[model samples]
Target: MARPVQTPAEVLGIEPAGAYHRLLLRAPGVAEAVLPGHFVTLAIGGRDSATPLRRAFSVHRADPVADTIELVFAEHGRGTRALARHRPGDTVDLVGPLGTPFPVADAPETAVLVAGGYGSAPMFSLAEAILARGGRVGFVLGAATADRLFGVAAARALTPHVAVVTDDGSYGARGRATDPLAAMIRAVGATVVHSCGPMPMLRAVTDVAVAAGARSHTAVEEAMACGFGVCMSCVLPVAGADGATRLVRSCTEGPVFDGTTVRWPEASPPEPSPSVEPREVREVREVWEVREVREGVRS
Candidate 1:
């Protein structure tokens, strides 16, 4: 839990995905303090031009040695379309290293990481952390098709065991990631499940984990006008320890919460959080392509 900071990061590179981009930056102290699941807010339309709110993105990766961080996102609307135009060497406003991180157990135990699309962003860091501690972790990644699967290659490097699911059989197994989740948990003898994705998908994951007697935690995706709690726009109903349901802000109280305690309320689509925009929704449905280009001078 390090204190948050507001600073500008010099964009080092941009990888163009047909529909999204991977931005790498030289962020002074961001990587040093960031942990798995922490996110940063980038000012839309760049360095105070007129956009009212900053966009939040999970910390995809942090390299303390390089003093850098990476983010993956798609440009969907007015604000993000502007964000997508940034070129290397430019500066982007950032406020964070914010929100709760996926808690890694001190003792070694097997873990099952479930990610949907860019939800895979934070999971890569979490998986790395878990493995660094000599614990075992597996990935269960899903998307609409092969082009959308975010971390299959990365997950494979971390562990030989990865289960990939897609709605359309474009690649990997054809089905929901959770379709094989229960069996994956049993096969791996997992002690816990960590998940992130659409609300309905998360709700399903919670149920599967609970039935398996495994503890579960989920990183929620909500729209946020502010990365801090002040906006009051990212609230969701989650039951408290005493069993009383209260609306909580995803920014401060959590983007991460006990899976079992969340109350999605109905089978309806998740409530809108500021982060809920067209680009994100489409990317979540299925990821866009990304083409990594470094230094501009390089081919």
Candidate 2:
């Protein structure tokens, strides 16, 4: 692990990737220290913004040689829209190589990496790392539609086992990405699974990996008010190796965690509570009682 750095990174370029934007920044120190699953936080809206929170994005690509790092993100709010407006020469204050990165196996092993939407960003770097370490890599990428899917070409460039799934059948298979994960893992003889996506998708990936008897690592997309560990905003319940589920900060302890270790939020329907009068009905009944008492007093 490397110490995170806060530096004023100059924007090198910004380009569109499907519905998202790929931002390149000149931050040699942060780029050099970044790992596959590490992310960077940029101060958006400049100095006059009301909110002081920084926007966090996974490190899509890190080029220490070029002294640059890339971040991929969709313009989801005012902050992101502001970031998207940055030009090549603009300097943006950023903190990087934050959070726990995906753990790569020292020994070469067959592995499957999964992504949903722009969550594919970090997986590309992770794939590169795995391949460099002589590990076999396969990708399962899914999104609501074809335009929403990303990194299909990038994944194919790394390996021939890339699987694409779209909810609308716009491209590839018409289903969730996890639909093919178990088969792919078995086919590839993968002993490990890595995933980054929506919580439900990650949960499904985790379930599939566990069923396939493969180790699972998931990078969560939790909202962080502070990209560092200060705010405790990105805390989630995760189980320890000892099996105790406790709150842990995603910023420091992890944005990546053993899939099995996360105490995933239960999806079960809420139990029916004891019957109670509606507020409106109670209020109407009270009004009726008051009227009756007034009539009796008049009588």
Candidate 3:
């Protein structure tokens, strides 16, 4: 069952890491409140103004005993910039535990985790979860350069089997992280692949996984407005079980989906209509709106 979405809590701590900040929030009574792959949505501005509502972020760490949840976000936009200015004891609005989590395949004989840029957040917890379940974990992280490569040390600490790839030669391999990922998968004979990253990297990883006949799951990074499914901003075309293509809302149905389920086009396809008369479309929209309203009231 889904956990009830909560209101924004107070900022407890802000630890800086390069250009990003690890924000610790106190959501009292929300103890043991989050699942491994769950995320939280935080409102940036005051309620009276046209606040950007809530921005969704993956829960990097959730400590129920401490009544705290942590989010690691980069300073990119107005909301994020504002978040950077917040000090301890400041209150911020939030609503969450949204969306389905990445499927945890039981100790997949051998598993490989591939992440790029900020995409490492979700994969980090996922790796830890898998390890706790007795699964062997290997990591392949790609970044623009050594400076942009975050979480390598942490990932390495979790498992000795880690490979870093950078666009520049400042890191492990001079090529993209996918190069090392492919190499590592081949060398270790990885059976399952989990990835979260840029679209190009995801596509590349999908191709590699498909060629190797490995089951792969991908966590997508898309623009989301309503952390629930209401906004329709994060819908992507996916191939359904019936072989027909359908649009799936990323916020609700998935931020993480099986790579094979996505309808990848060879060339740029035409945009899908926002208002289709299909029953499924209507149902999806309705469900999303209801969830949004419920979340709004809680916030």
Candidate 4:
């Protein structure tokens, strides 16, 4: 694969969606190569600071035709707050379509997707691919309240069965998203399942999918400071094919993996993913070296 790009992205626009903002950016080659589960890591701080830990975001949508990519986020921290302040024509350094993409490796009759909070970021792309394969998709989205839910209306347009769950019952259903997942899969005779969310929730959804006899895929929400495997910060304990437990970098081995094999915190001895020389590791060391150094950022 061609190496993921480290280029200056121009802000195209930002649209408000309840409590979240869908931020669009122009990122040439990056948009064309992105897959369903891929993400980008942007350098924060400023140009010529030499370094800044990256803030990762799932590729909410990538429009190759427009050479633009979109990310949906809630401003929960300094990184995202900075992202929210960007205006059209502003530039940010980006590195992506990184990480292992959701395995569209199988052709299923029906696919069920489960999301928790911002984990909904990656589902639309996966849904598009599933539809292209002549498969149907259904979503079970859950958040703290109605406003925390990300893409319910957009999801409703993509798939007929979009169910939302909020703890306060301010949305489509009460309780957790997993509450209705198993029944939905069984009702649709779903042959495959995909999920992205908090680790605890993924663990629960994986159990439900396994019990329902549906093949499952997961896009894990692991913190990746490097957006590549070098940082060793985002390790996940997973069952390797050899039947031995191993720790793998979530940035490389996955942001996506077989749900059934991930060793959840309580289930097994947690082994750290072993180190491997990552392929397609982008040369972000010189990020934006070509963009004329600019002075002054927001105070």
Pairs that collide, model 1:
16-291, 17-289, 17-290, 18-289, 223-273, 223-274, 223-275, 224-274, 224-275
Separate clash counts for every candidate: 9, 0, 2, 3
Against the correct fold, how does model 2 do in TM-score? 0.88
lDDT of 2: 0.84
**lDDT tens per residue, model 4, 157-225:** 998787789999998889998999988897767888899988888888988998999988988876566
- For candidate 2, the 10 contiguous residues with the lowest summed lDDT are 266-275
Ranked by TM-score, the better of candidates 2 and 4 is: 2
* Candidate 3 per-residue lDDT over residues 1-299, each given as its tens digit: 24656776989899887557889998875537676567778878777634444677877777889988888888865678888999999998777777777777665466788988767877777887777777778899988877677788899899888998889878788888678776777766778788887767877888888778778888777567777877776666777788866677777877777888875552112334466555334444554554454334334
Global lDDT of each candidate: 0.80, 0.84, 0.74, 0.80
Question: Could you give candidate 1's per-residue lDDT for residues 1-299 as a string of tens digits?
Answer: 33688888999998875345888988898899999989999885654565656788888989999999999886756677787788998888888799988899877889999988778889988988888888898889998878777878899999877999999998899999799899889888898999988878888999999999999999987767777877566766777989877666778878889998887643124323354555535433321111111111122
In TM-score terms, candidate 3 sits at: 0.84
Could you give me the TM-score of model 1 versus the true structure?
0.87
Write down the lDDT that model 3 would get. Answer: 0.74
Per-candidate TM-scores read: 0.87, 0.88, 0.84, 0.86
Using TM-score as the measure, the top candidate is 2
